[model samples]
Structures are given as structure tokens and as C-alpha cells.
Target chain A: MSRHLLALRQATIGDASESIAAVLDQLAREDPVGAQWLRSLDWAELRRLAAERALAQAAKTLACPLQKQYANASQYGTESGDPPKGTCIGVLVGGDTGYGSSVQLGVAIDGQALSFFWNVASQEAASGTLERMRETVRQAFREQTRILMLELLSEDGEVQREQDAAGRTVLRATLVVGGGAR
Target chain B: MTTKGTITIIAIPKSAEVEVHIDLPEVPECTRIAARMQAVLACLGAPLEDIQDLPAPRQRQGVSHAMRKRVRGGT
Candidate 1:
């Protein structure tokens, strides 16, 4: 499985523009018809994921508050979107992930699809799709020797975009083991 | 260290094996994921040529925790 983790090493958290665009794209899909490409994502020759709770479910999600209008996060608030036609795909019992230092992961969702403002107060789970279409080559490199792993846990958490001790728009979640998408 | 490109496979449990480090061009994350998955499938005894041609996965994203039937397709 380390090789699988190695595969995650090359992936970064995605730039703020990509993150914001993804948020918009997902939310727009929830809107009435003809509002698909509110944010343009190249679905061609791309590798993507759709999970039982995307948007913010796998790995931590990022939003540049300085670029809020571009973020299109107003519609969904801070908690973020979920898989349409959903179900409870995961139930994490707040515990510790035992891994050594120096392994990092940055996760995001990008595809020709959408996420929505889910009325999940009563729904126990969410649905999603994960797609891996092809491979690509760009220009980048890092001087490191080791391994990294990425684990996509959940996205649709109940968020309170308040300030931490340092006063940044930090996200904190209290996840339920076998409960609704709260 | 050899000058020629090489591929190595190690025996493991039910999981995939580690591959030789192919110092290729910049690739990973947004791309190469499909290629990595292809490698994994290949480790499982699937043909390489066929794995290379798999279409984008439209498979429904269903959770495997606390559920009965597999959930497919979402709103």
C-alpha cells in the first residue's frame, strides 16, 4: 500500500483558484438547469474523484477568503457540499492516524460535475462519484526522498468558520460515527 | 545504478507492489492518477494494453461503511 501512498505524494492541495472554481462548479450543478459551467474545469484528459461526500470530504478543503466572490461559497456557507443522491459512505470515530512525520497530502475535487447545498440535517449519508480518466505531464519538481499518503475522509461537515487563537478562518468539525450529515 | 529503464515488483499481501522509480517528467495529482491505478490493476494480473485504454470511471461513489446495498449515482 505504500506505493498507493506514493502515488499521493505528487499531488498538492491545488491552487486557491482551482479550489474556488471547484466550489462554484459543484454548487452550480445544484442550481436549475443551464447553469453548469459557472466555473470552467477541463474535464478532458483529467483525473478526478467523486465520493460519498465530496466538496470537502476527502482531505482538507481550502478557500481564499480574500477571493470570496470568486469562491462562490456564499450559497453553501462553510460546511460545503455533498454527493447528490446520497448515502452514508463513511463513519469516522474521531481517533488518531498513526503515521510518521514528513508525509503530507493536499486534496481537491475537479471534474465535469457538481456539488450542492445539501439539506442534510435529516439525511444520514451522502453519495458521490470518483473518476480517474487519464494522465498528464506538467513542469514541477521537489527535492525529497520518502513517501506520502492521502486519505479522503469526509467533506460535508458542520462548520463554524470562526477564528482560531491566531484569527484565521479555520475549520473545526465534530463528526458523528453513525449519524446524519451534520 | 543502471542506465537502462527498468521495472521492479515486490511481493506483498493482497495489496499492489512497489514499482521501480521511473524518473519521468512532472506527473502526479491531477494527472498520472489514472496511470497509477493502471499500474495497480496490472499488478493484479490485468493486461497492460487493456488497462491503458480504460475510459473515465463513471462508477457511482458509494460508501462502504454502515450500508447495505451499494449506493450509485447522485443528484
Candidate 2:
């Protein structure tokens, strides 16, 4: 019998302003062309851009077979007939505490989902947290997941404010084995 | 019969609160998967021992019986 796996990846931003700024700084250094547009964006625009970028990065890591321009949900695997029995991986970000933000990421094999989270209160902390989450994604791919789905969400607060707020972000995943009934 | 499993990992970066859950069918096929998960957690520097175990689901019949007895002997 063939085995199947699925994994989910996610992240949560407690203070969008700080998180956006941090992401923008990184982008400015990494992608000069994109940085130009990012540099001119206001706080509100930057927040939107950052969220989109995060989801895109997650999708890329999953190697989603069907690529879509929208940020939020994406599916990978087979389209027709019985999907091959294999593994799946997912990443998520969530848990936004007032002091900082928390990010969660992981993979699911068969019906099992394994996830990890990181909380950062300061920009410095966020930098490290992002790197670790990225590394976790790399590791999940090495483990071999056939299908991946990524979801992202942000809480409501002062959009332009720089202060951190209390909130929570959850990253969840589900898997099915043997390509059985879903 | 089909076997299934689930695992969840939660981490708090500030206070460093981390929680992991693993749910699998009570069968041998899951052994290798579990071991691989443990290895992944190790590579991530997450302690395997710290993962909290989820309580087994209560029997539906037992719950119903308890509810019936409680209703008959209303407090």
C-alpha cells in the first residue's frame, strides 16, 4: 500500500507595524527591485505587502503545484484520479502577544501534523525568528511531503500604530493516509 | 481498516512556551513516522520529552450513562 502525507505552514504577527518594518528592511537588502516599491509604501500599504509576501514565501516553500496570485490558500498534489499516497507539509504563523509576535510552522505525514512556533517581542527577535522558521521549512522538504497547504491571517488593531497588541494567530494542518476517503 | 495520525507544534518566542502533540493509530506502521518526527524535533532543538500527551477520548457510552444517572438523581 502507498503512504500519503500533508503539512501546513503559518505565521502570526502581533504588531504588524514592527513586523512589516522588519520584513521591509530585509526585502530592501535582498530584492532591490521590489525594495523600491516597498520603500515608497505607507504603513498601511506596507502591512498589506508584508502579509502577501509572507504567504508567497510559504507557498514557495511548499512547492505548490498549482500556483495562484492570491494570498491565503493554495493546494498541491494531483488533480484527477486517485491522488498518490504520500506525505504533506504545512507552515503557520500565529499568537500575537502585546510584547511581540509568535510564528508557527510544521509538516504533516499521513494523518499526523507536526508544527513549531516562535514568539518575538522586538524587531531583533523577529529577525531571528524568521530565520529559524525558514530553516524549519527546509527541513520539512527534506523529510518529503507530497502535498502542502498554507493559510495566513492577521488580527485587528491600530494599523498604523507602532505598539504591540494582544492577540493570537493559529497555524493548523490535517493529513490523510493511503489516499483513502477524505 | 485505515490507520491515521496527527501532530501539532506550538511555540511562544518571547516566554519560550512550546507545545507538541502527536496522534497516531495504535499500529506498527506509525513507529517509523514517530521516530522521524522525533529526529526532526531534535534537529529543530525542540525537546521531545517536553511534548504534552493528549488524554484519550472518553467512551461515549460511559458519558451517556453518567448523564442519565445524573438526570435521574437531579441535584
Q: Rate the local accuracy (lDDT) of all candidates.
A: 0.21, 0.31
Please report the candidate that would top DockQ against the real structure. Answer: 2
Local error of candidate 1 at residue A73 (angstroms): 18
Off by over 4 Å in 1: A1-12, A15-46, A49-108, A112-182, B1-75
Candidate 2: residue B42 Cα off by (Å): 3.0
Local accuracy of candidate 1 as per-residue lDDT tens digits, B20-50: 1222122222122223322222221121232
Taking the tens digit of each residue's C-alpha lDDT, what string does model 1 give over A141-175?
Answer: 00000010011111232333344454332222222
* Deviation in Å, model 2, residue A74 alpha carbon: 44
Sliding window of 10 residues with minimal summed lDDT for model 2 chain A: A145-154
The best candidate by lDDT is 2
Clashes of each: 13, 37
In angstroms, the error of model 2 at A19 is 34
Model 2 alpha-carbon drift over 4 Å, by segment: A1-167, A176-182, B27-32, B43-75
